[model samples]
Target chain A: MKKICLGVVGIVLTFFSAYAQTPQKDSSTYKSRKLTFDEANLVSSYYKQEGNNAAVTGGIGSQKLSDISNTIDVKFIKWDRKDRKHSFDLEVGLDHYTSASSDQVDLKANSSASHADTRIFPSVSWLIENEKNGTTIGAGLSSSTEFDYQSIGANINFSKKTNNRNGEFTAKAQAFIDKVSLIYPTELRSGGGGDDDDDDDYATTARNSYSGSLSYSQIINQRLQIMFIADLISQKGLLSLPFYRVYFNDNSVQKENLPDTRMKIPLGFRANYFIGDKVILRSFYRYYHDDWGLTAHTVEVEAPVKVTPFFSITPFYRYYKQTAVDYFAPYKTHISSNQYYTSNFDLSAFNSNFYGAGIRLTPPKGVFGIQQLNMLELRYGHYTRTNGLNSDIVSMNLKFK
Target chain B: MKLVKLKPKVNRLAVVAVSAVAILSSCTTVKEYQKNKLNDGEMTLSSRKIQKTESSFQSYREGASGANGGKTGGGCGCN
Candidate 1:
């Protein structure tokens, strides 16, 4: 009886130790440990031992996706294996983007929904990831036909793994530089200039911005995971839209604009719920305010469900609304005496809606080939503005693990 | 001019209404959404075990889900 009691006591103590110790995220959850080239019939498990994915997207927005009314982009992503200590992962990717937009419009034409610019952009990105300690770092560069922009960013994060992965904290920052071409006809430069050839001057505008976010992610029991993120952003330099135009003939409005330099802060949150074996619910909200005298808000929700082991579908919806800056007005409203003004629709008071759906498919796991090699996704989206502007979108992503 | 003063206030109310609708819709029992034990994770929220890619989510972007995979390694412009 004494021996039995001792054994029970030992067992009880062991359980208490486990419960008292801070729990940790199990490493086995990563695929690196489970996948083997031998398990799958591949040319050779030897190439780079990295995971890769490619996606192409085409979309339209009230104001061109980039400076063009409609845009298309192809993105390539790859993640190299982590170092021995699992201290960090090396990631790399590229984006090839092209945009075509209509030209500047007068009162006789509707210019709010089109872009008159045609250009191609190429961007490169890199990231370093730390899983065991919960942290990440990232950087990127992009070059466009009219401008070449470079960006560098980084983030630090920490989390708890006990009982459940209940909560986490993160901080992030980013900076960018833009070099734009300044070549235009004399008539296009605020009415007239002596030489149209004087446009060859290139302007290297340094617009730097830094954003800091302190976020907390918590698992409120088993069914829900909620995240709250608060951000502070500061921007300086030429932030105005160059091609936007405003008219004042009888003050018939055609466009709107706001100040170029501003600082902004936003508070946002996201919540995710696991409804059942195959269904998931997500919600997002953000409130934005800037020093340039503009305030905006965004809310989005999406529901995703697995129709089968190999197929999944998701439906998404978003609503955005914003108030115009104190200095914003429809063409000719700015008497030129006002320091800030434009007819750009992007700065005007308006609301919009975005609706979309996605379909995803994956071949059987461990099915003699690469685990992620055969996955594919298709997405379609629609956007509309209260003022008579609308757009459609299509995107596809393919992967090879 | 009087009507213009009311527009801003009206929009704020609309934002609140939208949130209410979302919270309420979440409570409804959709027949297609049935609970599954696989999601419960045996009382623990995270499993450190290296898993099948399909079994776990990849939080690979910065806009919402997070920039890194959270131990799920990856490099992407979104990060």
Candidate 2:
């Protein structure tokens, strides 16, 4: 009897110790609060286009242009003591473009300063999110600089998720304060010529834009999701470029002129549907209007086919149509008496078509044996406008984690 | 002029209301574990990073802008 009692006691003790060593089912979860690198993305693109209507040359010259652009974005994340998640994003972009039309800005000179230029933009944003409350707030500052223009922009955003966590509402406000340099055509330049310190010939004007955006996204089911976005934008000051020439019916040439203030509203809808295990359909539609008498409709659709869980091929098509703004007219069609007028073909009524295909690869082990290189995507697109403008673009994206 | 402009707004509102009603009625609560399809990279709601330059150029070339995750002014797209 003593031996049996001792054995039972030993078994009980062993069971209790094992249970103690094992984690409890209801224990509080702890997450690391340290900041850590999340991901980085690099995107690069090359674009080229050709047309006959050049606004800079009174809408009657070559509108040939080429641009090469690259951007890099890095993200980091951390958890605060209050258990709120914080995310930081840093991004920088560079674009180099050459325009034959811009060359015409100096009609008297060959290959002038306006022929080619480079622009640099950098921005940083931070967001704090409370997962328990399903709320987030963010702010960002950005700047873009080029030879003839500079802009500083700021934005703040807030988002809230529904109780069920199936829907979210977001609001954002943005402002851009910009300065545009007035460099008149060579022949148009009056007394003071090119000089480093001459404030006489070169002048600058301010252009300010403010916008408020609202959006709502909802998961309709396991396979379908949708979002509605709207923006109200207002702009004031130097709305037209000083070098864009306009030729009137009277055979006289002058710079483009537009109203100082403008208002715009655009509404958009996006929907994504997983058709099955192999295909996903993405669609977007937008309706846009502005006080300048411009109205436009845009529709885009894309279908991505998953060959494997890690690889996808997507094909996309877009159609856009817009009405000519009240102030827009063809070359030499505008009368000198008009208050506001532009020979820029972009403001003229036209339809455009864009089609493209892309391939994405995300290997389970890594991309090209590099564990941190998580994804790669390559895309090509061709765009054509009804007004005899055509362009092609090729882009690539690399994601590292 | 006011009435003419208001007509489009009214029509748009009606369309949105109907879409909202239809979507809400069809919505099924999806749990985290069942979000595999929605969480796919291709299912992201915003524009992709690769399309950044495309969007920029489109905004510059087109008369209409905004609501497309692209710039809404403040650049010298003089080309």
Candidate 3:
């Protein structure tokens, strides 16, 4: 009887000791250091426009054009030993466009190589975020290529959150070094125009732009948030298109010409408010000015209404107005005595309106029963300008995780 | 005459400054748990991903650009 009791007691003690030695699961301290796939997004859009103002035709011809664009971006995330989060993003975009005005580059030709073109742009970025310090730093490099143009861009950005995490400030600087092909109009070519199909016939000029941006965002309340943004931009080099034809009052035609340097300032504000469980209102406003004697204002509003937790509909509208630049004039309006001149209507005083609607779907299971597909959205917009330009666009986005 | 011309501009600036102060002073310190509505995707204070192409087109068509998280200049949108 005594041996049996001693054995039982020994077994109980062993069980208690083993239980005490086992480790408890604490998720707070366990972060995966390995890089993990975060998400990917694909966006596609088709746009068509019709107008009477075409800069390539001295701002008085068909501005008919159509473009199809697609972009894909993938992101990855990892945790470092210091508990900082690192993110990597890679993006690629392609655009194909056909323009009737560009086809008029050779006035007598029914069709020209400049009528249609394709563009490709790719960018990569890395960001490091320190949770303890509430700070983030990021840098990116981007490039764009087309038959007549090439651009290389670089940017760096930093952001910091307030101690309470209610407000944040960000600053960014960006630069682009671009080369534009000097594809002169056939009649305007100094030497007898070379074959359009020969790339060696064209020379490229440099155009560089630099900008600095600052922004601040704050959570005003549980249902409201706002942001302010400002940017200073400077550009130098050839600012006018080589192929654009400007007709003087005397009926003589020449290529557009303008000053090589410009300075611009733009200030913007954005606000988002949740009206209730079903509706959200987003609004934006901006004021812009440039040293070329251009001033502009823009206002936009959008309201998203949730019909269900997983589905929402959004309606939006925008209004914009701008004053003409000092160098802008209508076709055959410039005189020979003018030192600078352009027939580009985009630089002319005008008002524009854009209205659009969109639908978004995000389901817990998936967008369409595919586990990896997280969200899907579709949108359409119509635009009208006081200068008689009208356009329509349709876009779609798909997100996968 | 110069002061008279600048009067309206000064008034507009003062109004903006006053409104900003009023808005900031009304802010409440919200706890994390009470941020559910503000944390919603639609409530973000920046441009949405779906509006990317729209912004691009607008920038190209308009004389004014930048401060909207879109390209100020580059890549030649010369259609």
Model 2 chain B is weakest, by summed lDDT over 10 consecutive residues, at B68-77
lDDT of the candidates, in the order given: 0.43, 0.87, 0.87
lDDT of 3 by residue, A139-248 (tens): 99999999888999999999999998899999999999999889878899876434577777677889999999999988889998888899999999999988898998
Candidate 3: TM-score, chain B only:
0.91
| Candidate 3 local Cα displacement, residue A79, angstroms | 0.8
lDDT of 3 by residue, B21-62 (tens): 888788888888999999898988888777777888888888
Answer with 1 or 2, whichever has the higher lDDT: 2
What are the interface RMSDs of all the models?
11.2, 0.8, 0.9
Query: Over 4 Å off in model 2, which ranges?
Result: A1-30, A191-201, B1-13
Evaluation by TM-score, superior candidate among 1 and 2: 2
DockQ (CA atoms), all models = 0.07, 0.74, 0.80
Candidate 2: give the clashing pairs: none
Model 1 residue A54 CA deviation (Å) reads 33
Q: Kindly list the per-residue Cα lDDT of model 2 for residues A1-401, writing each as its tens digit.
A: 23433453354334334433333222147554776666778787889999999999877889999988878788878888898989999998878889999998778767877788889899999999999999999999999998889999999999999999999999999999999888766666664323334534467789999999999999999999999999999999999888898999999888899999999999999999999799999999999999999999999999999999999999999999999889999899999999999999988999999999999999987688656667999999999999999999999897867
Error of 1 at A15 (Å): 50
lDDT of 1 by residue, B1-79 (tens): 9889999978986996697456544542322133242243222222111111111111110112221122211212210
Which prediction has more favorable TM-score, 1 or 3? 3
